[model samples]
Target chain A: MMHINDIDTPSVLIDLDRVEANLKRAQDYADMHDLPLRPHVKTHKLPEMAQKQVALGAIGITCQKIGEATAMADGGLTDIFLPYNIIGTSKLDRLVDLHARVTLSVTADSTDTVAGYAARFGAAKPLNVLVECDTGAGRCGVQSPEETVELAQQINDAPGLTFGGLMTYPPRGNIAQADAWLHKAKAALESAGLPPKVISSGGTPDMYRAAEGTATTEYRPGTYIYSDRMQVAFGVGTLDDCALTVKATVVSRPNVNRAVIDSGSKALAADAVPAPYTGYGHLVEYPNAVIIALSEEHAVVDLSACVDKPLIGDTVRVIPNHACVVTNLFDMVYLVRGDTVEREAKITSRGNMR
Target chain B: MMHINDIDTPSVLIDLDRVEANLKRAQDYADMHDLPLRPHVKTHKLPEMAQKQVALGAIGITCQKIGEATAMADGGLTDIFLPYNIIGTSKLDRLVDLHARVTLSVTADSTDTVAGYAARFGAAKPLNVLVECDTGAGRCGVQSPEETVELAQQINDAPGLTFGGLMTYPPRGNIAQADAWLHKAKAALESAGLPPKVISSGGTPDMYRAAEGTATTEYRPGTYIYSDRMQVAFGVGTLDDCALTVKATVVSRPNVNRAVIDSGSKALAADAVPAPYTGYGHLVEYPNAVIIALSEEHAVVDLSACVDKPLIGDTVRVIPNHACVVTNLFDMVYLVRGDTVEREAKITSRGNMR
Candidate 1:
């Protein structure tokens, strides 16, 4: 049993108890609202955690890339969904390989993407394709409900392609608007002689409310398992609920009110704290101290507001503003129950952007 | 004999010719000015590149951590410098191991860090310690010239430490002020019966002006070997001079003015382009296109300004805002000369934060 203190500085430390609690809460919420939780593996790319989520009543796992889906399937996960408009011939070939490994589904917002998928899986088990709707996120998605229906029709018409359903990663805390758009899209699809089998909605900030209406049949929350500072700022959870933190050692105390940590932009990530929140992260031990800025290997902290300043060589845990990006930064993360190390989990799907 | 176009999308492509040119230019500038170049490995993190720099008349390589120094040493690099105030027993032990393998020197801005180094190597080869002076960078360094001299004296008095000299990463384009501060510090150290052996000043933006006066004896530049968008914005180089680029395919063209690429913050990095740089990165093919924002796996590019808009599946090479952080994001980088793939270089010291 390795101790938590024995682990190296600037390592991602995940609390197993907190993770389990978070997992249970989300699953229970989904169960109460009659929604199947298809937890996104993008947050914690470790397939073991995905397996645990599936064991804890999650319907399946959700990946954002073909590589991630393959990693999950290798971990023995039977069902996986990639909710993105995947394009390109090489990627579609890899997607076909991934689909053969598990019950896979992918999202597409355009006919070109559907055509690529159709070309690759022409003779295989029918590839499930979901139409991605915008729903006010203003990212990569179809513009209107009618546009989604047309894309669904394209998927339905394509060889070896099944129109799976609809999915959207809506803006955080705008669940009502997403619900409205999803409702309209569903009605439009129904009128066009196609009803969505699965209406997947995702966003960690609005996860608890995902199953509140008829629009979302399943939820695909990524950051809910290891709630971070961003989630806390969004009122989704409190500081106590944040399970993942980067363990950093104070390498230098340049002045009375300034301390530099080993964790910089590489470990803590460069994701700006989405507003209303200030600073790069929240220090667990010293709540008043702020991570003012980060260079590549140094995190400059402001300690003027803190009642107790950290001395050089002091270890501090920091909840990153965004946890998903932080997971992608490290090769391995240690899982701990309290202060006892459970095991180290490899970030299997890390840097698998292709 | 693979072509550049044959490589996968979102892969790091290193132009060998541009890299060699960038290296030669920096080395020639340093040689003409009589400044020893101690190129920082934090940018490339490859021992092969560090060895190449040493071959090109670099005095040594500068690393940000003990692991990087050890990795460089393993690749047969004999001399290394870590410009960081290292603390903690584990890290100091690693530092001792690193020093045994190479002619190593480290920087300290605090008495605590100096004491830790002294206690660890009391009976071994005397550890070289450079007192880091804050020449208006406002990062991890001693506040004033007096403070730097005091720290140098402390290092000189320590049992197993040699007062190497003064080092600072000054603010870019403010070399005159840094020169004045470094000069005063050197004079103060001389008055205290401790003449500085080496005065090191670093920053790629000021690499050309490193040895204009007697303030610096050596220079440690990280990004000159792979000039990035930020360096270009600082007037260090142009797009043609950049050696590293992320090759990405346009995955989606949501609208006539909006395009999404396979590379995002994960590949290109999320380091905000410091002012006068209004976007995330510089696209080589479509220079006018602005990489306005990035998600984890998607770079949302605004193509409204580009006359030659890239269609879906078209590959574009992007020069990230900061190359150092981007280098750490990938496992392997493909090295190429013109259109032919030379080989792939493993980022040996990547994620060596500890």
Candidate 2:
């Protein structure tokens, strides 16, 4: 029965109703497109949110870190997809342990990573391994369709390993290029007598546009559940669709045209918004105010164009540029319906970078 | 008893020998300047580091949040200063409780914050209050010496508040302007028949320049103990002076000129190195390699200029641009003397924004 004013300043607030709507939207989009949705748990980092996504018809969960996948599996998430290369002996041991607990799948970009996985899981259950393909993201992945097929062949031939699928983290809002690259990779795999079981493509920007005819059989959108300013700029959702925001108190009004909030890079995060949008985060009430700079614990706001400026001691909700990074900054977030708090949800997989 | 290679990737490593030297440097500088040093704990957020700093001749510790001060107080540090204007009822109550446990002092830029403190601690021990003067940093604090005197008068007239002194977080390396402003504020307060007990000014960049002629009687330098890339750029310390480094594994070699590390914005933080310096951090091994960009889980490195590039599975230590922000990104930091693990210290005051 805590009021909005009762909670301490500079805390994260999640609108439960908005979360449900966002989840439903993702589920409905997947259903309409006939795509199996595997929401990346790296965004929310909360098992409760993952469970909600699962209950809303997500086929499984995707995680970038072993620590995240382990936490999700421990929280009773049966199917988990780790779409990142798990290298080194220490990580392989954790991977094997997680494989025994859940229907686990992992991705690898190089033969060395695949070899490490095959050697470690040789005595255990057959681990599902996917070949990560580089589309347009320019991150970790094989260079060409031929390279992806070569890696897939290595996985298929390796002991105690199943050639699960092909996955790519495409550039935001550029699924067409990914579709073409994935199609070429799928064709190459088929021509090599090894078809990928699953063709996965992921990005929150182009999530709803993942067509049925595309090579992508599954979609993984991490930031969709908590649409941020970046998502809003991508034309995916509006400010009202944003579920999470930082409740910050204006600690200092240095001048009439400038004010500082309690939330800084520590709370709002240092993830810059995409072009055409500026500042750290969007102030819901003071729309014209731009958060120009942030130190460790202070967000300096430029209130020159604001029709009404926030006074010192007033609380304002700031929608950060990237909600995923913001969630990692806090230990617990408030689940709220309107102004009343429902409960506090712990960021279960927070700081699980390893 | 963990080996360096056995530890997980993307972990924070602290050098005890460097930390000891850093502590000695700050203490010796303060001792030579005839000023009491109060190191800010917001950088390390570890009780063990704070204790070590205290044992090395720190009069007290300073923290930004009450949560940090309370943690330090709990860890047995006696005196603490919170140099942020704390507003609202919920925080004021916590401030009073914190005052009851330790000798606590707070800074305020407005009369409203001072009034809140006066109301909360009217019956308790008189709370020491410092008038925060904005000396060219342009963040929080009063505008002029007159405004500083007015706030001092407010604190002195308040029933349970004692006008402790004046403090300012000056612009980096601009101690001259800060000294002039603080001197003006001090003169005004003295003219008003309220001689200040302490005059504090802090910035690690100009910490050594805070001599006896300056109005400042106390110095609080947060980043002096863990010099980072930015500190090196400021000519305050060299790369060898850095005590903290993030150990990261090269997970992907996209090409001969590029490699990706396990440490990203999550490990190294997104705080860019100040001007004239490029990249996210300084690579100790590959001096020519530039950390071009960082996603959530991958730090893209451009090794075009390096004589030798790092292969997949190779480990490198990165000295972050800002060590203070990097400290907040980790849950546990390993304390090391040479190659041996001294202990794993928990970041006790991390995420203590409230």
Candidate 3:
């Protein structure tokens, strides 16, 4: 074990105490709502974290890609759900292999993708398929509830696919719209005699306001484990709930008001979303100063508002705009408590962009 | 060998033909100008790429962090220049250990950073120090030419430091100003009987426009190897010269005019700088359509003007907004020649953010 002061600069520190508390809080919410909690492993991507979540009474785990699912399965996670459309012949083959190792389910928005999955896994084992509906995000999935029923029917009729549930990732402020869409999709599926058994819906922003009804049987929230600046901006969690931070050193104080840090766009990630507030990212301890801008290897922090200005050798921790993307930036993370590094966890599922 | 069509989706494909051509082009420019080319390894961070650059007649390699330089040295690169200030005690200790392993040189702009280096490496080995001068970048380094000389004298008087040269990374359109500053700084150092043996000026955006009589003996440009959307936007390179691209699958055609890809901010990096371009990244083959938005695992591409729309399973390539950050996003890259994968290279030097 090492103290926080002893750890090297530009390292990722995760407060295990906060993480365990977050896990229990989310699990208790799911229990109160009588829904299975399938937390997305894409956030932490650590096997130990996944195991901890499962130990805290999560029904299973959720993944956005086959690579992430495979990584979770390799880490002794027996039940996994990939909530993204798995296309192409090669990826379908990997899906079949993953299904052989664990209880696996996947999402699809089109008949072509469903057909591919059926062709690959219909003979060996029926592939569990969930219809991905676009409530309002405008990113992926089927547009209408009618399309969702049609896709579910297609999966039911396919030789090697089974209609499992309905899934959607709605826009942040449009939970009402998502509730309406999910209810309508559930009705359509039941009318077609193919009602989804596991209706999943949740994102970090609207997890608290998750709609309760027959349409939502499970919730998948990834970012609640390590809330970031984006979640703070969206009013999801406070700064104390943010479990992860990138520890960086102030390498140069070029002027009185400005300083350059070793952690830049590469380390912190350059995901500058339009927030209600200013700055590239928020400093964890010193909230007054903002990360004004970032170069490739330098983060220019404006320290004008702070009462105690950071010197050239001072160390600071920054919570990025998005925690998931920041986890992908590093190969490993230090699981820490106060000042002691309890363990060094490898981000085994990182860079699994397949 | 794998053909381009046979390779897996979301894999980094580097065109060796274009890479060789780019290396030769930069070499020719440096040869014509009689300036040593020290290509920054942060763009690729591959040992083979660095070897190829050396084979193409590069003097040495430049890295932004100590971990990168250590990885390069472990890959048999003996000489390395880190163009950033070294401040922290732990990092300075590692710098001394690295100096013992290889020929290590670093840049510093302030007396405190210079003193840190002197305290660490002054007794065992004289630290090769370069005075970093601020030439309109407004990021780091000293402000004026007189300050550059004063810092140089401080480095010289320090017990275990040697003032080897001067260095600066100027903004794109201010090469003339940087040239004037470096010229004055060189005169000041000479008048103080401490002329620099190596003067380095770098920044890919201003590399082609480097002024004459700047007293710059070396030029460091990192992104010239794999030009990106930002480079193209800055009028640095054309689409034909871009050697790296992300091969992504069109997972969803949500609407008639929109297609969502498997690659998003995690794979492509969300460094959406120089806005009004409106995208996390630019489409490689289809230049008309813009990647309008990005979620964690979905890249929303707007295809309103695309005459021939991509199908649900079709694969498309994307050039990220910034190539260096994109390099750090992936773990491996496929070297290609005319649609055939020649070799798979591990990005071993990635994630060295320490």
Worst 10-residue lDDT window for candidate 3 chain A reads: A206-215
Question: DockQ, per-model, please?
Answer: 0.74, 0.76, 0.83
What are the RMSDs of all candidates, in order? 1.5, 1.5, 1.7
Candidate No. with top DockQ: 3
lDDT, each prediction: 0.88, 0.88, 0.85
lDDT for each residue of candidate 1 in A121-206, tens digit (9 for 90 to 100): 76458999998887877678887898988888988888789999998889767888888999999999999988999999887888
What does the TM-score come to for chain B in model 1?
0.98
Models 1 onward score TM values of 0.97, 0.98, 0.97
Better of 1 and 2 by lDDT: 2
Candidate 3: tens digits of C-alpha lDDT, residues A1-354: 678888787888999999988888888877887777888988898878989989999889998888888888889999998988888888877887899999888999988888788778755578898989888888888999899988988898887888998988877887777888899888888898987898888787878777443467888889999988888888887888989999988888888888888888888887774557777777876789888889877999888898877888889998888888889988899999888889888998788877
| Fnat for every candidate | 0.72, 0.70, 0.91
lDDT of 3 by residue, B269-338 (tens): 8887464466777787688898888887889999998888999999998888888988898899999999
Q: Count clashing residue pairs per candidate.
A: 0, 0, 2
Candidates in descending lDDT order: 2, 1, 3
Judge the docking of candidate 2 as incorrect, acceptable, medium or high. Answer: medium
